[model samples]
Target chain A: MSAQISFRNLTLGYERHPAVHHLSGEVKQGALLAICGANGAGKSTLLKGIGGALKPLGGSIDRHGLDPREIAYLPQGAEIDRSFPIHVYDMVSMGLWRRAGLFGGIGRADRTKIEHAIAAVGLEGFETRPIGTLSGGQMQRTLFARLLLQDARVILLDEPFTALDAKTVSDLVDLVRRWHGEKRTVIAVLHDFDLVRATFPETLLLARTPVAWGPTAEALGPENLLKARRLGESWRDDALPCSDAA
Target chain B: MSLFDTFFAPFAEFEFMRRALAGVFALSLGAGPVGAFLMLRRMSLTGDAMAHAILPGAAIGFLFAGLNLYAMTAGGLAAGLLVAVGAGVVARATGMKEDASLAAFYLISLALGVLIVSLRGSNVDLLHVLFGTVLGIDDATLMLIAGITTVTLLTLAVVWRPLVLECVDPTFLASVSRSGGVSHIAFLSLVVLNLVGGFHALGTLLSVGLMMLPAATARFFVRDLTALVTTSTLIAFGSGVAGLLVSYHLGTPSGPSIILVAGLAYAGAVILGPIGGLAGRFVPRRHLEA
Candidate 1:
């Protein structure tokens, strides 16, 4: 019952231009895959394409039997709306939006899940607080609470640790490890190389195209990293391989 | 007299008064929910533009059909929707902000409406187009209001969740739903319908104010969507009554008077609202926390 995602010749971006051109890749069921790239290198765009936010500019993407709703994506922490007054409990409950009947009302079981998700993210006491009051780290934790409530088999995190302190980052890493161990596919757009090596078993490096994708140890090795850095401009070609460079 | 007798006295006196009251309620019902979404989407001005853009449509309908209320109303709705969609497309195509485009559309429509009316054979109908003063409220107008409210409400009920999702977090909604794009289109269409229907009582110039101010006032007292919608409806209806009574006593136009009443409510909310930007300075943080 493992979840799998496949991208075939997928080119993603705006209607006028393509960002990730003709890139193909896959995440095996239950793999913690880190997507790392420089700014504007199509890391976020590729994640959005996989999560079905951006329709591919060319080719196709198939998520074998897995519903898009069953995929949870935590956009960059700062991108969330904090102004309108809403409590953490209700925010967490939104994960059940699709699961709630067409009329969209949450039931008792859904409430229990919301509470459990809040507890999972160590936000037990903060359930009723307005989401706007939360610190940057706390907001990220609340987002995690929401994702956990979704019970999605696939978790896509876009730089979830950007504004957090070092301690919070480690704690988040532990949570990702726990999720990975439980057979959930975790693909995150991460900037921190150390965190990626420590937590993720696989890595997908991109700079407008797939530069390297493989087991974490091989992909993050010194030789492969150098190749990835050098291939920054011409990464769209896809003719070169990290293994060959090594 | 009992409080009810005083407050509800106008309902008993004249048929026109009753129709006017009914018209207010119908307009509020559609405007309340539609306005809430507009505020959520930060497109309050879009409602403003739609309100104004309907002018030419109403004027044209009046010119061609000559006081045929239904035809005029239909013309206004068609023109309003056309301008709304056109503005959206122009914004998308040219990298222009929607509000900026809407402002241009409103000006063009308003001018065209005035120009068309000027060239027409009758100069008498111009009064209804601008002020919407009480000339003679007809059963047909009531029916029109009721029909418009029903359609707007039914469509809103179906698309409530998606529209809300789209407003609160479009990126998240896009990730979860298979048809996010479709839901967005439907949401905008409902807004257009609601604005077109409500355009009669408030006029295109002030319709957005009526829709927006009540909701803005309600936001001071309520946090959840259900409470917010209900409170806004009450505020709108109450303001409508106040405006109607003021106009009845002073012999002023109903539309402007009603808008002034709602504007006062907005001022009160802005001063006394829990998280009122200015009022926040005086109130303690714990008191304002939702």
Candidate 2:
């Protein structure tokens, strides 16, 4: 299968200070990849670079044949404002944003799709409830419903299971499996090594740079995990800028 | 005097009162929705900043046109847009918070506006500019306010979807489409336009009062965006009517009276509103137990 996404010597960071440095990798079509790392691992930064939310400070992120709109990105829950007065249905329907756009009407077919997505996430009666009234798990479910509606070729999930209840995590993990089964490229930043080992077929352990890559079992070995922790600990604010060469 | 006579007679008898009422009512219609969005985005104070940002522009217009409505409106729009866009750019480029940059710019703009107005116009003219001349509203100014209100409402309708998305989840909006940036700029422009409109009716210092007070009040009453906007507009309109009546009867300043009435409504909602109100807090945790 062709690579759906390729990062070549990519360095992404804020203010010329690299969070992710000289990372080179390819995500094959329909690959289910979990990115694991300790705190300050640049896992989220990698996702942001690929999702085109942040520009590459050095190098490039090539989106093979996929258009920018063909990718769906779910940022961390902290990035979303739950206090805003928005209905669950309305927020979920925003997944169709690329298709319906600013002024486009949501046709009956789209409405049906939206409804199906909401029902699929076990939020059947939450259509009219304001998002602020929802619990964290319910809100995550609503966001997943939105992602389902996105129906994109590449889906990037940043810390998808953080702070979620076990039931909600398992249910959303099932959806992720379903997406992989549907032959979509899925990349997620995860902290749970046990969950990654049990589910993800491929894993990338990163700490500012690639520590290991390949099958989950081989990539997440004890040595590589320890190295990732060491790399994170040694990272300093005044560290020398990373060069383009990997 | 009868209640009807006290409330209706002022508007019925005087052309100026009727015009003032119509001007502020239109202001309420547009300002309420924009203000609700501002509050939702946590940019309520940005509205205040933008209000001050328009002052130097309006004062420049006064200098050039000598109280000409068109000149002042155009100038205010220009200045307001400049400050808003400038603040946004500075925030993005330098990593400073938008509100901080907006504050810096607005304070400078305020000083410049006062200095410019004082250089050309008298203290009386300055008071008129700062406090507004709602009772003295002419047909041209009235038409301008109505026109701005119409444009604001229509633009809001067109950008409503993206605007809500941008407010609630800007990162998601950015991922989905390119219109997120467009929606933000368009929303800020609408805010500037409405502030200019309200400035004519309520003064630059108090224009945000008409937009933000009713919005803050409505939040206490409604959980849905549609209900919040509708309730806000109603509250603003009611405040306009009540403020006009009070001003007419007591011979108080119209603009301040209008804002004061809105403030009073906000206080009432905070105390007695069903949602998150102080009184609601006292209603007990029986449901929590259940």
Separate DockQ for every predicted complex: 0.47, 0.81
Candidate 1 lDDT tens digits, A111-209? 888898888777889987877788888888888887877778899999988978988787778888889889889899988898888787789888776
Give the best candidate by DockQ.
Answer: 2
Q: Point out where model 1 deviates above 4 Å.
A: A1-3, A14-18, A58-60, A65-69, A233-246, B1-8, B89-97, B100-124, B282-290
User: Which parts of model 2 have CA positions greater than 4 angstroms off?
Assistant: A233-238, A241-246, B117-124, B288-290
DockQ of 2: 0.81
Report the lDDT of model 2 for residue B36: 98
Q: How do the candidates score on chain B by TM-score?
A: 0.87, 0.93
How well is each residue in B1-290 modelled by candidate 2, as lDDT tens digits? 99879888999899999999999889999999999999998999899889889988987887788888999899899999988877777886788988898898778877887777677656436565688888999999999999999999999998898788888998887787777667778888989999899887789889899999999999998898999999999999999999989999999999999999999999999999888899879877557752
Pick by lDDT: which candidate is best?
Answer: 2
